[model samples]
Target: MIERDPLAPSRWSAEYRTGEFDEPFPWKPVLGVLGIVLVIVFAHLELQSKRIDELHTAINARLGGELEPLRGRFTARLSTLRAWLELREIDGPKMRAADLDFETIRSGGLLSVRRKRSAPGGGSSIELDSDEFGECLGVPSTSIARIQRRLAEFTPELRDEIDRTDHFLTLRGMQDQLDRRIDALLPELSLAIEARFLLLSEEDAEARELMLLLVDLESGQEKLRMRVPYEGRLLTARVMLDETTRAKSPGSIALPTELPKGASDCAAASTLREAIDGRHSIGEPMPEGGEHAAE
Candidate 1:
């Protein structure tokens, strides 16, 4: 027999050696995936915490830095209104007392921040209501926005207040109380006046004459009272404008029909007596010149 070569390939051994079992890697790829997932989870948590802290800081800055000055302004406006009312009370007596108490008229939601997460592609924005802004500045909702325009000069400050917004909701209980007071006053004033007039005037021959005289006197008083509010409003506007910009220009509004051109010695006697009882009235055009003269 020929000597067998150890290195010679044999058909049976080659067929058997074609496939072999692979050795397992010492470090599992599954463990590497698990570690990667853990790192992602930790990073997400840290980012969320940092965002929360940023939001908290923003709120504090708005509350302490911005809202405090706004509160002071509101209080000052209320005080000014009160002073105006007091001046009128001192000057005119027929008009009922005006004690619009600010303590009772509670204000809420000065500087509240609302955050809404964005939609898929949209960015977040804030909205502010005019009524809410008015309340923040201690102005009536019916205010003609003069204050708004004036305050707009302080743009950065106003924008900050507008952005860090909060809902200003009045208490239902307080609103109900206010509603009741308004309701009681609305229908009663005219009725009370008619009743009082009837009680004062006799139902006989002198009744008509006495009623006419009383009407005349009341009309004069009404004119006087109207002047008080007009003058007070003008003065208030002037003061507010001065406070805002140190402006010294006299804001000349159109003179009404109550102020006459000439002077009269008697208290109720009108210089334009003919006009007062006739078509043309006091402070109205005296035939030719326009209502407002050139500067």
Candidate 2:
């Protein structure tokens, strides 16, 4: 290259600069980033799918094999509790009609675990059956659940009954701690309970064994809840339904059905108000299978 000053045309007060040249874009880095983003998105979706499947499996297991049956057992126990208190019917399918009797009106599910309390101070523990563990965990688990607590919140009568039952148990069980005047009433209550047994009708006895059963833990739940009517207030409930001669009446609700198979979830007693909602102007259609309970 030679430096030479040759024939220059001069322009006044203008600076010289070069223009920008066009070049191919940097596609590789951009494509790598896009591919990484797609991979991340796909990975997130796969993780979500796996979580959903696990949830479904857990729910099914809870419903079918382990949890639900224990819940049903515990519900049946409430009926047992009711009988112990000398309240009304136990509609375990077998108790259906034939008596839609006065007991039927007081009808519902009850469960009992009958093993003499070893006289309060005796260190005797009842040997639990394999299913007993299921019952223990299931009741309290569902007891505080949203559906059940809502049921309690909705029914003041139920809350009252629970309080009443607890009160009765407290008074009766702790007679020594009671005031003198209230203690005197216990004898009269016993007499009243005895009279109820004598007054119980034959037909009423046939359905859910209108009396409470007194037995040991070895007797098993099947024996405790057996539909054998008794003379005094006894724990007798139909564990299995004799569906053959079952008479159909909406008023005569079945144990397993009306309860949506969950009694702690429903009610022992329903008044005229509960049976029908009068607030609604028009009648609504009935659902299939009838009285389907909350899941």
lDDT of each: 0.29, 0.30
Residue 181 deviation, candidate 2, in Å?
42
lDDT for each residue of candidate 2 in 97-198, tens digit (9 for 90 to 100): 111123322222112222222233323432211112113322211111222232233244632443344233343333333224223333322222222111
Segments of candidate 1 deviating more than 4 angstroms: 1-27, 85-295
Evaluate residue 267 in candidate 2 and report its C-alpha lDDT on the 0 to 100 scale. Answer: 23
TM-scores of the candidates in the order shown: 0.27, 0.26
Q: Tell me each candidate's RMSD, in Å, in order.
A: 23.3, 23.8
- Against the true structure, candidate 2 reaches a TM-score of 0.26
